[model samples]
Target: MKSAVEILSALAEPTRLAAMRLLWDGREHCVCELMRELGASQSRMSRHMSVLRNAGLVVDRRDAQWVRYRIAPDLSAETFALLEAALALSGKPQRVAA
Candidate 1:
């Protein structure tokens, strides 16, 4: 479990917040996909993902040469609710996997 401060701090960045919102639609995203979607460099996206992972907000899995990320399944209701609130504020469309 992560402290609320830790989670909030991780989400405070625009890139990290955007990444979390992308995962909110219940789909795992590969680093490449995220980089393309965010128009961020690989190093920037990876660093943002690393922050989310360290905050326990997201989990990563190895899939061949790709590293995919999703919201942590074990998140507490409070934490999830916080993320939901953030998503609401973001006003971004839900991502649908194709």
Candidate 2:
């Protein structure tokens, strides 16, 4: 289980919230796509990613040189629900990428 501080910290930033929303459907996303979508610098985006990873709200897998990130599978029910709610309000429409 994650602590309150971890959860709060993970949900603290707009970018991180958007990242979580993007990952809500259990899809893995390449870092570059996230950068493009978020219009954020690589370093800035990476810091947000690191925070979420540390809070256990997200997870990453390496595919050769690239790392893909998604919402962690083992998230607690409450946390998952909270994330789901947040996703509902995250403004971006669902987009399918080839």
Candidate 3:
């Protein structure tokens, strides 16, 4: 059983939540694009991405040197609803600041 704390912790950070919003808006985003928009170091963004991935809330696919991350489609209904509602609350703003 997944801990609620673990899931909430992964969503707690503003940057991580923003990243999810971005992906939720675009469906997928390459690492460079994420870094540019989030103004976060590659390693930093990757760390959050890894956390999301580990929580089974996100999915990634590699295309050449680019890796794209997005909300995972295979999650349980509960998580999917949570993510959808969170993203909805996050709203559809333009690309984030660099």
Best prediction by lDDT: 1
What value of lDDT does candidate 2 attain over all alpha carbons? 0.80
lDDT of each: 0.86, 0.80, 0.79
Say which prediction, candidate 1 or candidate 3, comes out ahead on TM-score: 1
**lDDT tens per residue, model 2, 1-89:** 88866787788799999887777666899888789999999888889999999988899988886678988889888877666665566
lDDT of 3 by residue, 1-98 (tens): 24667777788788989888787754678989999999999999999899999888888999998889876767776776666666667674453432
Runs in model 1 lying further than 4 Å from the true structure: 92-98
Query: Comparing 2 and 3 by TM-score, which wins?
Result: 2
TM-scores, all models, native as reference: 0.88, 0.82, 0.80
Better of 1 and 3 by lDDT: 1
What's the C-alpha lDDT at position 77 in model 2? 84
* Candidate 3 Cα errors over 4 Å, as ranges: 88-98
TM-score, model 2 to reference: 0.82
| Candidate 2 ranges beyond 4 A from true positions | 89-98
